[model samples]
Target: MSMPQPERLHLDSDAATGYPNSPLPVLVYRQVLDISNAEERADAFESMFKRHGWPPAWRYHLYDFDHFHSTAHEALGIFRGQARARLGGPNGQELMLYPGDVLVLPAGVGHASLEADDDFCMVGAYPPDQKPEIERGDPAQLAAAKARVAAVALPEDSPAGGSLAELWREDS
Candidate 1:
């Protein structure tokens, strides 16, 4: 059988928190990820979500082609440059992603990224189930994730607005 797509949730901006938040009656664990190229991986992300029961999310990403990285459920990161992120922390951790690298934050995990790159591309993910508490990678990986964890907007801004956030917030 094909790999299942993730479930999509609705979202709203936590004007209070700056980070996007899930709507009431929804869960807050979104995912983040990356594959290779922007358009190609975006297509894959779309299909991946649909295959798993997520709403069509690709449309929310059309405007983010430069230094792009998303903060949501399991993420897909195809780095054109360096990037940073937390394994799971506030603002996530700080790390970096290198060119031609693909980072997959598969399924439900509290995560986010910072762009420490020359230029990069990535997509966020949100698996319906809670993620396993995997051990943090060694210093090398930690360093990388930190670089990938730049402030969400400085890199590419929120590609998905209220509507997309609303869709993502359903289970958050």
Candidate 2:
């Protein structure tokens, strides 16, 4: 089954926080999978993403401290419980993510987990051939991170199973 287009959330770079937020908007697809079993839900997400050229990388909850990836974009498929997270940076927007919600974060956008239930979990993935590097909002690394973020190539497909360029290229 095909999913609907995602909701886009745009964020700006924060000079003070040294967060080199991306020009590309974060893509949020809500309730894409309604499977009641967490393991099955995660497997479904991984299979879909792998079929679309995004390889499943890990399974975990979001980090408590704000951080970003500079080398590759990220896809987080929530399979269990719920959490409220800060996106963009420390002073950025807060969003509640529930089971079956898929969050796509472009390179350089900051994100952090504010709070979550004990069972909260997600499947993290990256585009084919793109490796992720974690970046804390450090002043000394801002310039390098910005350069890396800009140089990172766009993915050929969305983890949710569509042409990522169609959604991500318009603004890029």
Candidate 3:
């Protein structure tokens, strides 16, 4: 088998180029269950969503053995213990996600990680309505946002480029 390449730069908003333009593009997220006995995990997972205002309306998938790259947006959350994502090579980028830690997926982003050291669970956050795709920014930009903007929006799907549109954003 040929070696998979490590993309030094993650492609996020660029995925839109592959699809026909849309007024409102579909955004995606996921809810990961704790790694435990299947039956118990399933039950608890169901209950957790209920506590939220959610009604199990969205489509989703469960991962058991094989790691899959989602066509949909993905973020990481840990339910039980420490969870770490190992980027295939020395790409100098690895998301060190912990319990309650959230990793937002940009438009065309992909990820793969080894098994969890403890039970891992997370609820991925994405917009149901059309939203501008967003990705992690460079050091200067990230620092500036934290310093200045109460909240900054990164445009990916929206009909804008390079930055967030404050008027277009909703309450987080």
Candidate 4:
């Protein structure tokens, strides 16, 4: 079966909070995996990431408050339950994500879980050999974070599957 294409969204910086959301568009791929079992879904996601040369995939629940990663881009594959998450920044959009949903967050994009089912969980990954630095809407880190976000390179492909280079290369 062919993979479903992802929906792309580009978010701008939060002027009021100085949240440096990413210039690269966020990619949301819905129902990419057909598995219903959480463990099976997680394993599939990990394998896909590994195939794409992304490493150190981890499984966890999302944080409740808004936060951004300044050092590296991240990808999350929903393995169980459902979640309502806010992305971009404080004033950004809210998205309802379910099992089999995948989100590719560019570096410096803010994300937080507003609500979720008790069993909500996801598998997260980063580009090969890169580490993520968590920043929680810090005013002091705004300038440097924005600079780092601006300088960060795009990933070669979507964590879910398929080329993301073209989508990310477009001017936002």
What are the lDDT scores of the predictions, listed in order?
Answer: 0.34, 0.91, 0.32, 0.85
Error of 1 at 135 (Å): 24
- Count steric clashes of candidate 1: 73
lDDT of 4 by residue, 42-95 (tens): 999889877876763689999998989888889998999999999987888999
Greater-lDDT candidate between 1 and 4: 4
Better of 2 and 3 by lDDT: 2
Models ranked on lDDT: 2, 4, 1, 3
Off by over 4 Å in 4: none
| TM-score of every model versus the real structure | 0.32, 0.96, 0.35, 0.94
Q: C-alpha displacement of 76 in model 2, angstroms?
A: 0.4
- For 120-166, candidate 3 gives per-residue lDDT tens digits of 55544333332323223333343332332223233343111111233
Clash numbers, per candidate: 73, 0, 4, 0
In the range 1-172, model 2's lDDT, one tens digit per residue, is 8788899999988888989989888999999998999999999999988888888999999999999999999999999999999998887999999999999999999999999999999999998778888788987778988999999989888899788888886464
Sequence-dependent TM-score of model 2? 0.96
Candidate 4 has its poorest 10 consecutive residues by lDDT at: 163-172
Q: Candidate 2 deviates by what RMSD?
A: 1.3
Best by TM-score: 2
Task: Give the best candidate by lDDT.
Answer: 2
